[model samples]
Target: MFTSGTRQLLAKSNKLCLKSGSYLKTFSAKFTTCDLYALVEPTEPKVVTENSPGPNSLKIQAEISNFQDIRPMIFSTGIPFSSSFISSLPFCENSFSQISSIPLGYNHHAILDVCSSPEMVLSLANRPSLTLLPPTNWADKLQNIHMKVAPKGLTNVFNTVDGSSANDLAFKAAFIAYKEMRGLPDELSEQELSTSMDNASPGSPDLSILSFRNGFHGRTMSTLSATRTKPIHKVGIPAFKWPAVDFPQLRYPLEKFEKENAAEEKRCLDQVEHIIKTSKTPIAGLIVEPIPSEGGDLHASNQFFQKLRKITKDNGVVMIVDEVQTGVGATGKFWAHEYWELDTPPEIVTFSKKMQAAGFYHQAQLRPKIPMRQFNTWMGDPSRTLIAGAIISEIESQSLVEKTKATGDYLMSHLKPISIRYNKLVQNVRGKGTLVAFDCPTPEYRDMFVSLMRSEGVLIYACGNRSVRFRPALIFSKSHVNVFLPRFESVLNKMYKQLWS
Candidate 1:
């Protein structure tokens, strides 16, 4: 139970603290205990110069560009404070800030505390190949980290290295489960084993995981097959002939377009069924994001997901909810799929990012019969798991999930008018928590708008070519929004004025 007065005081204190270099030292002195919600307040965005990367970033970039492809390189910041310059405007000062991927902000106290613990240090120094010889406390760490926030009815976890690998592993589980149901024996026969060497049937059977156009899973071989966000990520890389169905493209101002959006969802549902029934390859599973993140922060109603779950159950196809970008309290709920309230849990729910660990949660039945079938040398690092445990503890102790919901509502309420006022430049402002986004008129315009926002000292990210997605930390408070909104409005006004001028 966080009081508004406390929140305001903390925000004000943090603002003041950030302005001074002694904030960290003061914070360390004041709060010796590591409590989760102990620091849910706004911190000042450090701008040493007019630009983010300042002079230090350019030198680092110039040095790195000589050998490697530095196209994705943003400016770099030193330790304690991570920074990235907006690459498009190299000379622009105040252009570098943390991007949306930052969960608790750079060098979060809780995270650093966990890293400094003896248990964490040991795990990092003596990294084990978890698949073969996991640490003694691995099971306990899993219970504390992933299992603590496990979605309803999911008790088992298959840990992997990252989001893409998590989804890829889920796909493999689905394929194995489907084959087992088809009377395939646990042990491969001599013929099957020999044929598998040549990538033939019985081993490499004609199976596929159905995904949605514009949905992004990952860039790995199997996950890439399921990703359809952009051709640039797939070009020159071999991809599977996996089927992609249309995700519902709902009309904006949801209240005004409710009837049309319902019809659109129904149409997409029919298309999904059609693909499952008619594909040349058997559909072993269907992977969908609770919100199609990379596909432009696209959303479907709870009813839409419930109906999809029923459809998958009826067809004996595994239902996988890829929560890589939406999970771990970003979307109000710990798991975004919780919003759906389906009769049963998704067969697999994949997560990464904020969790600081990647894996799929499923029922006991989904576990492969043989151990080595679904394994890797370092399935997931224990130090990361330890950090994840700390994160979960902090989230619960501080009740950040509910806090995020409240703050997100606050943001959206303020953002709606901005969207309406600039309807031509900005449209379709929608999201479940702080995980919100809106579309700009064009890709170039969206990029420009993002750049301007960076220049104004607010960090944001782009998704689906024309949308600006907000992925702020759960600890973000209303005061943070107050600081952000004025800057955002100024940027919007500048854009509008520039366009007309």
Candidate 2:
């Protein structure tokens, strides 16, 4: 897969390349990648067969192929994906997103209570076109639910169906804001109007959102242009000629390489400034993931992000922080970028995943001045908003964010020593809260370790090319960590001994 030089270069990973970037095109979502958290829990992984996707699972997959694409999870069974109950099979599920977007785990009590409510039943039964038909309490839903955990400084919200749609909504808001800031009229000129009708601009204006190398935003045409993580998601689709710059590949044990990492951040910032200044398609916005999870759980310092805020402010580019993966309490903070302490918050913050509701929150001005400019049929389901509200209530009352911080510290502390003990097998063990990940010596070893752990009854996942990522639910505790760690260590020991030889 690589020249010796290429292998050695990735081993160091000094600068993350954008196009043709080094990404793991993991064959199965169940087997590879990040964020798409697989939430298996409470019980240990159960494995009845020597090989996963054993005969029974393969037969189930074959049935799926009659109507759907089953190549990705060719051996998946619905049982492992259920958040309601532990898999009857030998492996504890990673609690990953299958058909399940379980908040607290599979069928969390709080979530179940909400879903069982008579009010919830009514809401579900009478689903309306939120944009066309009216929900009298819709504004109330946004205020009481989303605003409760709303990213700092954002006041307006536009809801969508999923993370990808959330991002597309954010991109549109940013582009519209960019044009408004340019003092363009809502009513276009004859040329602008006519050209836009034909999908050209001054109407469809040549504007771009600057993304980083290995940043995965979404699968939509426009947002996909801002996505630079892996080619498979974007292949055969015509991408907007948007500019993407390097995402910093800062060294791990960040405190250990302060000077070096700081220099890397500076280099990336310089590239960002250069692209914003020179790209022929005027840069309308800049989108960033707090951790770049799908790419490899890669992280940059708070200082790096703060500097990005300042730069976008100076350049008049709308700064959109894509928190679809890192939002909620997963990163110890309700919003991961909260650690950045930027004097100004990102102009727009998009969220999904754990929120269970999908949308972007923005400052008042980013709201389109014109009607019908930013809209969809069902603006977002109120039922999902109710679920999000319940999730919020649970997280706040439980103090899950603070608890996750403490638990994550405990987890990371334990992992560091293991990373050192099995130094050849793993390295760069890094995390914030329970959102932790570590790199294996190679992709083969990484996959083997993940599979081995599941066999031993501890389900986890792989991300990027060489990192194993942990994205358990907010309920995961030090107690759960205690249960998982010994199992993880056992698998690591066995894998190191057997595979290293």
Candidate 3:
């Protein structure tokens, strides 16, 4: 049934092509193109050695750790093992292994095809400073891809280098808009501009971006001031005296505790309004994650977000939804906030990770009257945008968003019972699509669970104090979930027995 030509391509590509049963079957009936590309079956995890960071991986980590923190280092392996590991994992296939930033999968054929294109090569080789000299195709690229997918009610885009830059830019836009709303002129007087250099009020302006307790924006000066997850990140740095509001800590199995959760949300919303109304330094904006990811995979209801939106709008506070870790089809929707069904979209929605390009989408009003005020030498990279364009195209072509929604439901259904069975170690099993998480009884137990999982050849991570979060790629399939569930169940059973014993 093998066509000599098809066989040649497969051999040359070193990719597998499965034929349907029976050499006697007609060639066309037995060997379709879909059979060649579709995930045929889940592969078993191959742990060649007892230890996760096998001898070769340990050596590589040691060499790299000398020059870098490597404190968060996971063992490194050869491309073959890396690729194999990905194929067997839930979030990304090992073929194109990377940090969780991978959108589709490792060595995704679509991405590789884009990479091999001449235009992509040219963009890569001749990287443009997008703000100063945007490529001729920049407008088309934005209109066709990024703009096409903009959150409802947002019509403008301010491209940046990454998630932190997106947040920083959004904060700047909010600050400017806040000032303008308060009757500040577009052009600051020479005297006011001069006084700004001295960091005095009326020029530098006494305003802040209110953030929730334990929320993370980024590590840049302004962003760092708003981040409050850990002291280790802020130990020696001088942070702004910005107001911090309490993010609701709701009891989980969210349905069972609805009344309590509502009260908690109301309490948090009240605090947000109070901060805006009474802060010594006026609150120009409020930034929050749809679901607090790095902070702890914390989630609030749609009602909570809707209320926050209303409060911010009424108080003239710019509402910024940081979807850096939650955007681009992972949460069953392109943007997680889409689930909120906001009366009007948040004033700004910042994105990065899965989209590959970082930027904030906003209403046209957020655009500054002056041009150079909100810019940099390289506002964004065209090569990255091209890649992002290709990614968005693939998502549309393959219907990966709907696929992710279905696959995520399968995975969560599998996790729910595990949470019930191992009630002590696993609690609050909840998520939007594959953006799921549960809590361990304690930090030590959480760390141990993660370690055991890695030892078993599954890479995972913990967030907040005692929560484990899953951030798989959009292309992750139900078969991948099947591969991970048993391994996860085994680990949970082992942990439960050990804790009980």
Q: What TM-score against the true fold does each predicted structure earn? A: 0.88, 0.88, 0.90
* Highest-scoring model, TM-score: 3
C-alpha local distance difference test of each model = 0.79, 0.79, 0.80
- Residue 225 local lDDT, model 2: 90
Candidate 1 TM-score, true structure as reference: 0.88
Residue-wise C-alpha lDDT for candidate 2, range 90-205, written one tens digit per residue: 22443243321444665465775687678899999998788888689987887899887778788888889998999988888888888665666666589987888899878789
User: What are the per-residue Cα lDDT tens digits for candidate 3 across 46-159?
Assistant: 566688667877887888888997755566544543233224442323212253477976545566557667898898898887878888888998899789889999999989
| Global Cα lDDT for candidate 3 | 0.80
**What is candidate 1's lDDT per residue for 1-501, written digit by digit as tens?**
336787567556754665564555565655642321344422444345577555787787788889987767555544333121112221121111133344564455677788768898798899999878888887877787779889899989988888989999999999888866456566767887888889998767899999999899999999999999999989999889999999999988789899999999999999999999999999999999998887799999999999999989888789999998888887899889999999988889998888887888998878888777787888888888888887888889889999989989999999899888988788889999888889998999999998777776565778897998888777777877887787888988998899976
* Candidates sorted by TM-score, best first: 3, 1, 2
Off by over 4 Å in 1: 1-43, 46-53, 80-100, 181-187
- Cα-based RMSD of the predictions, in order? 5.2, 12.7, 5.4
lDDT of 1 at 439: 94
